[model samples]
Target: MTSILPLILFVVISTVTPGGATTLATASGANFGFSRSIPLILGISIGLASLAAIAGLGLGGLLLEFPSLQMGVKALGSAYLLWLASRIAHSGSPNAGKGLAQPITLVKGCLLLWLNPKSWAVTVGAAASFALLASTPNRLAILLGTMFGVAACMSLALWCSLGVLLSQLLRTPGHWRTINLAMGALLTASIIQTWR
Candidate 1:
């Protein structure tokens, strides 16, 4: 626990960021409810935890050695975020057709996790910090994963509840569209932080 403080701190910071995984989760949960968003949430957890573990184990330094690799990662992250924004821009209402629900799919969830630059950075940072502080790498990885997992869930739940509230209160059809657009914009804005 003592060695994992930095990992916890890193995850808490990222989990609270505007365009983190919680943003996507909230948006999905709002539009389709918790049942439909489970896949996405799980994908985020697995992807983030795995990446964070890798970084904690010394993968980040190796990654940094390759400038092209870093550039590619950034570019991929930016492009993916832009694409998500576009999807939101084009999507119809969650309840557009009678009894129709556009649920969050596994593929999309994977994309959200795999392409999120902020997630990668946070994961790497958490890993690096834990690695530095822990006497054993395995122990550090578990602690980091546990800390991040809890913080991420709590933060995401907050956003999801907020999304649910917004969905119910902002009954106007256009408002839902706006919420989607807002999420997309936030994702786009994350690029600035991720790149820098």
Candidate 2:
């Protein structure tokens, strides 16, 4: 149990911190409510787990071999995140006609992580750091993937719940605009931090 504590800490810290996915989850909760954000939460968890599994299966080595490829990914991810931030920043209140009418779908949520440089970094780091979790590489992959999935589910839910609570306090269109802009700025900052 003691040996697993570090892994737990790492998972919790990685998932709970404000990042692109967590920011999106919070915005979803605030705009669409918790029930509507469930699909996105599940998709993010599953996508994170899958990425961890892939990293453990040796994608890390591939990235290490091709530094240019990694740079390409980071560049593409940053551009995509910038676009998402713009959308969030411009979003109006749910009650207002200017806001997004539909919640993000499961597939979109999954793809978001896949395109996020931070998610890749976290998964690859976890796969490398927790190599001792299992004897075999395949077993380690499964264990890390499962662990990440569970942790992500819990942490992201908490973020979403916080958003729900904030939504209650921010009912007006102006208040929601403020929240959306703040969320977008935070997400943009996260992206900038990832590069540095």
Candidate 3:
């Protein structure tokens, strides 16, 4: 139980905040609806898990030590979030893409994860929980890390569902615009917070 604290902490923080994945999820939900967002969610889970695997394999520690590098990532992530918000703000109508909305493509979803700094942090920090899982020399750690990956994916689904709920509730274009701006600002603020 104690060993899982780091994982819990990372999830709790990243899930609630307006980060790349969460912000994009909400926009995708509002634009494409729940049915369409499924691919996005799946893509995100896989993308993030890939990062987690890399961190588990050892990369985060190197990046984490470089403050400038981390800051650069934050700036890039903030810019992307702002771009996504703009896209949502101009997305025709709240109901424009209903019948003909395209699903969130796997490539787009994966790209979002790669560009998100918060995703990288989560992947790195998550490895801390089950130290044994991160122990490269210990075969047992690899198995445990794999288990953690599964749990993380499940949790991501629940977070994506909240975005779906918001889309259903915010049925008007005005409401969606407000949501877009709010999500955008939140992401920007999160980036600033990271800097502070």
Candidate 4:
């Protein structure tokens, strides 16, 4: 009851923030439309929830114990984000040739969630902070994971919708290129935030 309030607030704030998942969702929606971005949204929601569950199950402590492992994960995630940013920056128009950039696939979306250091940070932090509220760690993890899944879905959908709306304004190739570059910059910023 009262104790769950903080957990809820944490989930809301974390999910609503512009992270890798949200940025990718927006970019996917802008490039491929809402219907095509469904797989990406689903993958992100499922992957994030699973991560939260793992954190609650005490794997997060293992990560904390192994600083080198954590650093490795962060390095991999940062590198992937930089690559994604470059792709976005150079993406072709929506109606371009067959070689135009495609939206992220479900597998890649899931992988991104796993590799995202921010996801680990938020999930592990939430699980640790809210563990005292439940009788068992598993119960706490399940509760947090469920809440995060719902909040993330809503937040991702909102960002995706915003992208779809913005797509209406991008009529020319130059317009799309500019928008893609801006989105790429946003993704780059997310990586920079992780480093800080």
Best by lDDT: 4
Q: Kindly provide the TM-score of model 1 when superposed on the true structure, using C-alpha atoms.
A: 0.85
TM-score of 4: 0.95
Global CA lDDT computed for model 4 = 0.85
Off by over 4 Å in 4: 98-100
Off by over 4 Å in 3: 1-18, 65-68, 97-104, 133-152
Cα lDDT, all candidates: 0.68, 0.85, 0.63, 0.85
Question: Using TM-score as the measure, which candidate wins?
Answer: 4
Q: CA lDDT of 167 in candidate 4?
A: 89
Compared with the true structure, model 3 gives a TM-score of 0.72
Per-residue lDDT over 74-130 for candidate 3, one digit per residue giving the tens place of the 0 to 100 score: 777667656665565455445565321465587777777777787777667666545
Worst 10 residues of 1 by lDDT: 97-106
lDDT for each residue of candidate 4 in 54-173, tens digit (9 for 90 to 100): 898888777789989889989998998899988887886677742226777778877888888889999999888888877888887788779988898899999999889888999998
Arranged by lDDT with the best first, the candidates are 4, 2, 1, 3
Model 2 residue 70 lDDT?
79
Clashing pairs in 3: 132-141, 133-141
Tens-digit lDDT string for candidate 1 (1-196): 3554555566787776667566677777778777777777766666666666666666666656887877877788778767766666555568675222465566666566666666766777666655656677776676666666667667766776777777776677778778777777776676677777
